[model samples]
Target chain A: MIKLKILLNKLTPGDTLTFFATREQVDNTCAPFSSNGYQVAWDQEAENRYLVRISK
Target chain B: MEDSANYSSTFFFCTPLSHERIIWCTECIASGAGITPEQGRIFTVFLTGDALFSFVDATSRESWNALSKVPSVQIVADGDELRLHGLCVSVARAAPGICITERGGGTLFWEQLISHLAAEWKGTKKAAFLLCHPPYMSRIPVHMLRFLSGAYAAGLSPELYAYLDGLHNIHNGQRPSEFENIGRAIATLARKSGESGKDPWFAACSRCATARGYFQMNPGTGYCEPASSIDEITIRPLKEILSRFPGFYPILSHTSGGIVNPDRSRDQDTRPRLIIFITNPPYGTEWTFGGLSLALATAMEGIPTTVVFIEHGVYSLYGTHEVPPNDKVFNVQEMVAATLDIPSLCYLVHAPSLERRGIGVEEHLIGIREVQNNDLAQILWDHDYSATRILFF
Candidate 1:
């Protein structure tokens, strides 16, 4: 939750952001962000990284 | 091979007769002269026996007649061409007044004849032309002989002709051997120009050629090499993308002699870090999967990672679409999607299929924004999330 606060302060519209979290969090976490009008993109696990592209 | 002693000009011609019999006669003539076959330059011509009578030049005609009369030789001529089947029967086809005009002396004509013969005729294998000339000489005009000799070589089949045509088109009038090395490499890769297959690197190279005009096609070599600035763009993008994530250490491992390893550094404080990998592995080689596996292992060691599998289809990820009766196709997206519920994890899936359906980076992030503002985001905010990492491949 503290990190989310920091991320919210750091993030803005049109900025590119990345995140590292377990598979479970990524799937559930994005729905709320998406319903609020932010853009999001993710790729399947390539090597060890799941790529997500976000826009607000 | 004594280099000095073997330095003699020779010519060759194709005949309907067997090459083994002609070589036997050549050895006999050499023996009769009290010398070995290697001592002098000899030109052998191959043609049918019935074609010998068309010769009108008295000297060549007489020589052909006399050679045919020899007990060891057999003459067969068809139309304007003649084949002498015996030792040293060097006449291919005889035509009356078919003289080659030269600005220089008549010796130049003989030299030209020698050059043409040596370059065009060596033997026939698999019913197709097999021309082998000394490496010291340029092997031009061999392309012409390939067509002429095709009838005796392999039934003059259309497939053979098409193969020759492809060779000609690729070379742009250059000799076949000019691109021999690269041609062999391409063949080894089981690829040809404009053909599509599972090999992403080949596809990438072809794409690079088509889009940027950076790769030059060497038909004889059966390979392509970078020729322009555009050629470097594909590799350069990876470097640029990786440079953006300063917090994540990069590690590049060289899997082959031609590829350079990228830079990777590690720091203990950045326990959760993002990593990106981008590479086009060689096609049809075992290392393609091995390379992917290694990249995966590196990511699982606590460093978040993303890999771009360029030009390859999803089939490579899961062996087949019709999953076995007992098991299901492993959906990487579903697993990553499940991670949304986890407090400490974030997952994103960017696939061409998904992108085409209007689910792209921007759209995905919008979802992230919504999730962060809702009750889920409130819950995480109340609990205080840990440090974050971002991985790109």
Candidate 2:
């Protein structure tokens, strides 16, 4: 449980953030930026953790 | 708390500070179960500098109907979106690596590596993405290699210390005849009881050439069996552990930059081994068959033999992989499976390589283990001496 904006503050374009979350949460988390111009991709990790990459 | 909508940009990949996890949230218009405004979050993972990847649960999520249709995708650069998606895992770059093999404990290894990195990268902005496998263990033998191997794949990519298996000292080079001689001598005593004793296994295998005593239990079956050779004793459980967590082998030591340059001469072993680097798919059956056939012949010589899979070669282990018709080597996969029974024969794959292609260890054949890509260099270093040639296909 973290504030997604704080991560956006530290991340330069091309940085990636990896964590475990459900499909619904992930879509919600990315929805705001995806509607904008942020370029992101999704990946899967062990234990169902999702790897999301953003390059905006 | 800042509103989630306040953040403007979304990207792929980030580097989290030590002891901390980070996230980035954004909104989209995708539909799925429990969907809330189609939110997306970015999390941290492996690579050089920072890592970038893409996925949509990467699993066959029944609820993720929209994502399930795509199955695989990679989001590396900015301005990239899921043109089509279900799931994917990307290969991040190699990081710094260090190993404390059999000689020193983990503490010393880490301290030394940190010091060395500090010294070497003194004016550079390079961060430490270290792979650590010290000679100590909480779980004893099992998880130690995986911890090191997985960490290596996570970004560590340098060799920090020398490691020895100590298998040489465990066995004193006793050939099968000596084993037989000793067994026969012991059997003579059993005659006093008027009961014939069974021959102690390992009377003449090179694997026992230097073993004091070597034995192992079968994994598929619980039966205790004589170790075919000395190396066999160490090999059996090592393979079993890898099978239990097959990806650890690949994750520890597999990478493109990690491979020995084919143009350069390979390292030599006092005891020459048949080391085959498999680098293709079944569709390229000629190369695959050639390597597999040579591997079988080499194993017959009682030489320490191994098959290393790189790139798409990792997929060859898939249970569903079928030999192409008109193949020179019929049932190549079966041949590989049969070869596992020989203790000296080894199989290694790269975990990230498989993950990059959305493959899992459970989907592969039994007995094969995955190591990190970088481990290949160390394997060549540890096994192959300078001035030798390793057959590559």
Candidate 3:
């Protein structure tokens, strides 16, 4: 989604952003970020929730 | 800002802006960036793919007129190509944005983009693409080939990452009747890249290849070896994709369905992560398996990815699967098992879905977390942050 891009525009390299998502959303959206040179890491926070932390 | 300094080139593909969004896009590009028409910035907009329709839309007339007032603005379209295709479209004004109506009009837009990229590159320009389908699944692969050929002809190197079923594109001995041989085409492209002195980086996901029988485990070394494939297609571990192209560069992902365009933003920090919901069992349709391949590829690429089994999708998590001996069948369960240990890949099953189907957690393979309905809803809500996306298979 472009929302991440808009948020990204506000930050610079070395900045870290963290967000929560469902398993489904994470699988669908993470590739673009990781592929684009962002460092993406995630862990299960609950039964269906995950915390996705990304760094440029 | 002088008009000369205001000149900016923005490339747009696939559908022209409608009247509603034209003002915003133009304003953002022209004035919002601290440059104005008075300062003498020439803003160029190149649009292709069904952009012809913008010419006839009644609402677009006003926007075109408004944009025309900005003397520094120049709008260019693939006018000749569209017209030759019987689109019969034209720009509303001769002044503001000139329609490229000459025979070379079609290629002129791409040439300019290529030139701009080359200038920026100061060397060879490269565009990386992700292919996610087999040869004849759809015309998307063909479309990718066409785009790549154009770029290659323009002296820009093109990179391809074949994931999921797209690994089939590199399978050796592919025979298709009366269609472009995608395998051979890619091989040819790779060869051309070498001939042109550009590094050819065409890779397929090893895990995907293994699952599809293209990579087999060697009994001696316990390492998987590429079983058979066309020349120039290198089978690498999925993780290699993350490091293949460093920094943020646009990687166009093509599936049989369509292109998954990345966010046009230049920042890597804000790119979106992906989630795929497998809501059906295997063997019914390709969605379940396709979703699995996508999940594995993304996760292996180091993207935080999750595959959730919800609704009927929970069925996929249940039971160990067995393939008949000497039968050519993809064992979905084995594929899931192989992915269980991959870092960044999580598997979840909706508890309510399993209960509704009279299935128990004990019946399913270990490692898959089971979530209740409320938790699932909350999970979806939490994921609403930023641009995180959810897809159903």
Candidate 4:
């Protein structure tokens, strides 16, 4: 299991986030976050940027 | 301003289709005297939204026609060439190219056409280009105009910065009709070209580029003041905080050398004296309010002042106000809507925003007012107050 640090200064509900990660580890990493109620909005294949919505 | 000036003006024809839109290409030539189909061959370049059709001479026409079938083509034309030069579609395409790229949507296509002609044409002296559209259009967006001006600079042989300075001609009048012409021209150019030069609003800023004085956005990074020099002052908002202050008179100044001073010297004065500045300034460089410069001047004498900056969608207020959450966030359009209706003694302080981008807190203060939910006069009053501040950033 790999841990990633998230910066949350100006993060808002509708805003998007960008990050880099390997294709194989994406689904495994997202399962726990999703189960905890976080929603995955967009996963950019080329740039590896992800947009997620956090529950208010 | 003169018909003969059109001959020396450089012309650029931007279309979405590489060769398909021959009708528009012909129209551009006919508008300018020098362009004849026999002598002027049509060059079509494909770009986003639609096709760009340019007319040039034999050699360039052959090159232009070769790429007629390609996708995303942008065409450039020289004075002597009857054919057009086909360039990559996305080369300079963005806000700067909005005038040239977005013609189908009916932005100011004609103004940009003339600006292109002015940029490309050659003579012993500078010539004016007449931008023509299909006809029957009302208003054009200022941003589009800015985009076109920047695009014309990108396509021409000479440096665009100098060309833009000449076209703006800001030295002569504080408010010049050429500003409108340049605005119109820039809008047309952006529709033809897909590229948005340096910034989305670069051309608009370029019009005031030669104006003397420094305009600093980030403060410490240094300022963008030209050598020409103009009076510089900080803008503050007085209405929101200082409205309660007795004997506080607001003044508006103008470039025309006049002062607007409202009388608030009367004892027990219940009426708020509002003085609005409205005037036109020359196109090149100095920061002058579009129609509000005059109003400021009219109110300058014996009146305490609050300055407002309005341009594009941004607004800022100067003088006194509670600190807003964000200093840079403001909506001039909404503020104008609110200030126009209130009957309180209103003084419209008109000034150009020193910064090219974003509205500051000070500009918003002078232009905006809060009204209780249902009062119509308050709404209308607020709207009037905001509308009184002219935009010429």
Candidate 5:
């Protein structure tokens, strides 16, 4: 799968994320407290290929 | 039944974005006038792309039914403390867990919300069918709905993981999801029939209704008989049910919430992690020896031992208050030292329980990892798949 590292400083709280058109084409959603990906408050892996999370 | 004073209650503006949505309140302050949406006097909960579920939890049945039918994002003025039950969550939010005790409009824990905006993965026929005519539950079961709701609220698909992490510890080994099913059954039956059971979910409930022992306890005594009550279905937290009838409990497996146990690969390794969870304190009698000897035996067998202290078990790691004792049972410190002296053996203490009991990490024997209660599942589940056998004391 295509993996991308996000800088915490650039991201804002309450921002939703949807990763489409990458090599994997899977949704990468992450929200709540992203302790720079340290403490995962919300990480939902949907049955459909995408990892359900906030994509902005 | 109509009181003008009652109209002025806390209306929770539930939404997916708490920080951003609060800006709407700021807009109201800026305009100095009540800005009305199409629904008029409504709470707009902004959606985070493709949400799949939403529900309402109110104190009054009338308020519940009214809000349940409202298809719009806005919740019309209802009664006091009308909670806008949207999946209010932020990924990577740096808050140390939701303040569970906080109860007010626009404020709720993540797990308490479910997804209702399913726009992306609605390609399948089954997915589309389920999304249409979503069941508007009048009553929300807090414990039953926590995990699934939290999963969806945090923008995760609940279908992938049908399990509530920490609740299984109380249900005689039954998963929290299982307990939630029973609660949902009561909720469903209540929605279907006006009569619903209003007590602890079930007293000694059989794992299944038609078939017995859906949740088996012991070899012979497996079936749990229902309580002699009047209602068709009842609801209560699994934790509450466990406390009310302090009897046998399901052998709950832990998994630090959604994060799976990390000990599976250790199966091929030479040593296995032997986790000893002790809930009872040492009474200085033969009672303490059961766990003590069991721990000693495993360590003697050369298995990598990791003793976990929880509840009253924190006392297991506590230092003596008085002078040195002459009793043989007090050999706890000595035996623990010997066990720890082994290269692989170690100990873990639940930090919350330790703090509750007023036991400091320094007060105990040197060299033990003090972790949060969330780590219990990972610590236990890791060993569960491996060769190490867990013994409770």
Candidate 6:
């Protein structure tokens, strides 16, 4: 989750970072990004996979 | 973090398990607009889902073989040892457009595309997406809403064209016990866009809506009125979609449950031009019908459009076809002929596809410019990397 945050922190204000992760990873990542006023959204791609997007 | 300004933009590619699908991806990546290793685009290709094990499959070996030739494509595993006959999985281009690494675990393609929209929406300040799936039954409606939400959060106006069964999304008073309330979400977004003075435009096809019972004849006005749908949507004729297209940049549409756009660029083109490739036969499925519908619709609206019939799609233009009275299929050849009259629509038939299928130019529809395989590659490269979008059906 920290690695995901690090990945997202690199983006500019209008940049959206898309990564493949698990549900837990997305759930843990969303609050940090959203609290910072960045937009985060995700959808389940498969049974175990979730595609997460966070925009800064 | 690499400076976002330095690189054109980031792109993600997700492929399904089918070898043919992977072959398409390989072709796109190997082609000019795909990777552009010499260019500044950052690509993270996800081979997750059923495609994760594609490297080991016998039928997919050829596809992977083609992917290996692409510059900077790598499959990293076990101390960075390149596996799968020295062919790697995933294509990631780092700074200066040199390094390539296959990130092992990743999300699906649609998620990646939705994520990429932020960067895509930045230049346009407006994004238009086609919603053909009805709500509740398919998760695509939810996904579309998520995409719109993300775009809205980034300050981009969203335009939704509910066509086909997509008209079901705008139906009023949707209350799902276990799933997201798509209708309410759409209304909220519409309200927000209206508040922002962005001229919120959420339109559904009147023809389709009336067919789907979303529109009814009211005796008082003697006109078709929206019924059982949220107030945020306006039912309009299908041709009106053309006007909406020019007003937005980077229009996107997908087949059911899938995402298709591959390249996202920093250079933005406000001109809404479309290139639709028909690679399937006319009567086997709805692909030809749908592709031609969009081609005619957009061209009628005067957006410069090109329709290329490649692979089996060349079959669409070959010979005269007669669907028997009992058979429900429309003669796709007639559909191809209908577009010939549209001045703005240009039709191209792949020369190699014809040769492979033993089809001659004289045997097919007239007015189609025959494009060589190499030239087709060049045309695709030019459109895909810039503001123009290339769609495959």
Candidate numbers sorted by TM-score from highest down? 6, 3, 5, 2, 1, 4
Model 5, C-alpha of B269: deviation from truth (Å) = 5.7
Model 1 Cα lDDT, one tens digit per residue, B1-393: 221122111212331222222332333332222223443323223232222332343434554454444342333322222222232133333332233223332133333432333233222111112111111132222222323222222322111111111222222222445443322332332232114322212112122133344446456654445453222112221122222222221111111000001111122333323322222222333233323332333332323443332222222332212335775333322222223343423332224423333433332232332111122212211221111221111
Tens digit of lDDT per residue, candidate 6, span B1-393?
A: 111122222222222345654554456445533444654333334233224345556777567655554553532221122232343443221112223333322222333444555454345677666877688887667656755766666567788988877889998888999988999999999999889877667999876798789989776654668899899998876666656665435455543111122344333444546778787888876667767777766765567788988778888878778889899766676566544655677889887778877886545476678986556645544443234555556
DockQ of each: 0.03, 0.01, 0.03, 0.01, 0.01, 0.01
Model 6 spans > 4 angstroms off = A1-56, B1-17, B33-36, B39-122, B195-199, B255-269, B279-286, B310-315, B325-330, B350-373, B383-386
Q: What C-alpha lDDT values do all the predictions have?
A: 0.29, 0.34, 0.60, 0.27, 0.32, 0.60
B112-181: candidate 4 lDDT, tens digit per residue: 4434333322110111111111111212122223333433454431111111122232122233343354
i-RMS for every candidate: 16.2, 24.6, 14.6, 24.9, 20.3, 23.5
Question: DockQ of candidate 6?
Answer: 0.01
Where is the poorest 10-residue window by lDDT in model 4 chain B? B251-260
Fnat computed for model 4: 0.00
lDDT for position B263 in model 4: 21
Candidate 1: list runs displaced more than 4 Å: A1-56, B1-45, B48-54, B78-125, B130-393
**lDDT, model 6, position B290:** 64
**lDDT ranking, best first:** 6, 3, 2, 5, 1, 4
- True-vs-predicted CA distance for residue B261, candidate 3, Å: 21
Model 4 ranges with Cα > 4 A deviation: A1-56, B1-56, B71-105, B108-174, B177-393
Give the CAPRI rating of model 6.
Answer: incorrect
lDDT-best of 5 and 6: 6
Model 4 CAPRI quality: incorrect
- Candidate 3 chain A weakest lDDT stretch, 10 residues: A1-10
